[model samples]
Target: VNQLGIGNYLNFKDRLRHKNGKLKYVEGSAHRLDAQNIQVMFNDVTSRVVAEQQIAEERNFVFHSLDVMPGIFYVINHEGRFLRWNRQTEEISGYTAEELRHITSAEMIAPELRAKHKEFVASILSGARWEGEAELCCKDGRRIPYYYVVRHFKWQGEDCVVGMGVDLTERNQAERLALTYLKEMQSLSARILESQEEERRRIARELHDELGQGLTATLLSLKNAEEQMGESPMVAQVKHASSIITILTQQVRALSLNLRPSVLDDLGLVAAFRWYIRERVESAGLRVVLSVDKDLPRLPALQETACFRVLQSAFTNILRHAQAQEAQVSLRQADGNLVLVIHDNGRGFDVKAARQTALAGKSLGLLGMEERVRLVGGVLEITSAPGQGSEVRVVLPMG
Candidate 1:
């Protein structure tokens, strides 16, 4: 046997022949065998070489990909020292390759998160994949949040853990902005609701004290004149005027109550709803079944108002849109929350379409109800479909 090249094996046999009284040596092997045999071995060797070259190229591409990837990539040894890191990792940590070599991977973790970092290392050492969010302490002493994933891997015959991290700065900032915007919106909605209530109360007072009382006085005057005038045509006209005044007074009272119910401000939510269902809903030919918990604790003014108004709007919508004959309203405290559900068996409409319409400003009443619920940090859900019953659920956090 003789070595031909790297990874290439060739078989050779030496034969001796007597040529002039001396032994002559000649080399003969698989390569020097029949032409067909040599061709077959050459082809097999060439195929293997080509395959190996392809594998090498693939590995090179993978390394290049890792280096140029937009995320941070790093390798840490069992001792938690960084063995290697990609360019992004270096840029994000504000450390060079040489500087990283002197520091352990744990050094890059924030001090408060060192315990969690240790746990991750232990888990990786035990062959478990770990993934979580952590703050990375950069070389400039600034901490940045990162979402990271690490797994145990064997690199160059050494047990190491490889990790990848994506920066969460932009995502976290966007989330914070969204939360702030939501809070602002809620505050604006609350203000608008407060203004609306104040206006309603003012109008109700004016109607009761001015319009209502004036109508009563006029009716009394007409009654006196009718009694003094004797049984004549003028007396009949006075009686007719008195009757019209009575109807007008009653109408003014009903309108005032609808605008700002005195019971809602005097009693709590339950009493108000009971009166509303009896006087408004049932009077409008819609049978209402109301269930309320006993001794319901008084909620904050905002929450109570929000809940009442939401129901009022719901009833209005039911009457205006839902052609259902009966409706159900329930209120109770469950799991630290005040839960209200209103269901109507009416010709329902598409809930999604209604919401889109409300967003488009066409359904101002529905939108107002939603805003009221959200102002109190509550959620409103409406379940309805064409030709199906509609259910509105409101959940308000009590604590």
Candidate 2:
């Protein structure tokens, strides 16, 4: 009223005690009618004021909920102005609340990803939900990978984007650890295979050089004894012993060759492969067609061993499980890599299930072949289905 007397009008809102002893809000106005008279009016506004207070309380609750969430949350306008953000946004970005408000969303993205961020925003604005991964650049220049999901909506009558981002640091670390462990396991397996080959070679040499020669000398002695004691039962017994000794010598020679074929060490991979196909595959009653590149050069010892072992394993599978009548083998050099493929017409098994079984340790032949190829930094692929034939393909780098 005092201000209205000096001026023309006055307006205000104030709380008052109601007749029933309750607090009420009022919006009041006063107008000076003349030098000595004034008009005053008061309008009840308790409902409007109470509703506004409730809305403010709810807004605060929502903000608190966002802050307690596990990941980064943020809201930005079409111009990329930060309208709201949670505690994680500031924490991960290494920026204070005030600093974030002054920067745009693109400013937080790594420079190389800023352009992509713009496209993501545009997509959201065009009414499509966006989800992808990007690197966030912190204030300290640290780049962190984050997977984000964003949507467009209206905030207080203004177009805005709301987004959530999850950190991928732990996931990436776990994957790296798994890869490292796998490599170590493969290296150990390669060493074991090398040791086994060495042992086999030693055993084969002993059987061929010692036991084989001993058996041959004994047979010669028995033959000479029979010649000296003619027309006697003792001569007949010595002759019989000579025949038995000759048979034993033949068996020993076969075992030695099967353990480690001397041809492999002396004549190289081609000779070894041809010998195996003729002596092993055909002897097992499986007709085989072999094609080789005439210009294929000799490979490193380990590589040649890996290739030969894989071939043996594949053919073993064909004979034991494929139930096929015929098989085909091919070896060639292309792009500085050795390519070997084997196919069989035998009844095939499910490749995926077989692989799973092999991985689970229920089967070792397939797994062993795969490990041999991997040890040499090569790739092995097996394809097959029930009622169809099976194929094993291997590619090894020559260098």
Q: Pick the candidate with the highest lDDT.
A: 2
After superposition, candidate 1 runs with Cα above 4 Å error: 1-64, 115-119, 125-127, 231-240, 347-350, 384-388, 397-399
User: Which segments of model 2 are wrong by more than 4 Å?
Assistant: 1-62, 114-120, 127-130
- As a TM-score, model 1 comes out at 0.78
Using TM-score as the measure, the top candidate is 2
TM-score of 2: 0.81
RMSD of each: 8.5, 4.9
Worst 10 residues of 2 by lDDT: 112-121
**Local distance difference test, each candidate:** 0.85, 0.90
If scored against the real structure, what TM-score would every candidate get? 0.78, 0.81
What is the alpha-carbon lDDT for the whole of candidate 1? 0.85
lDDT tens digits, residue span 1-399, model 2: 668778768888999998899999999999988888788799999999999999999999999999998889999988788998999999889999999889999998889767777777777888999788878789999988889888998888987899999999888899899999988888888899999888888998999999999999999888888888989878878878898999999999888888888988888888999999999999999999999999688899899989999998999889989899999999999999999999999899998899899899899999899989989999999999998999999999999
lDDT of 2 at 357: 95
Model 1 C-alpha lDDT per residue in residues 285-340, reported as the tens digit of each score = 99999988988888887898899999999999899889999999999899999999
Q: In candidate 1, where is summed lDDT lowest over 10 consecutive residues? A: 35-44
Candidate 1 colliding pairs: none
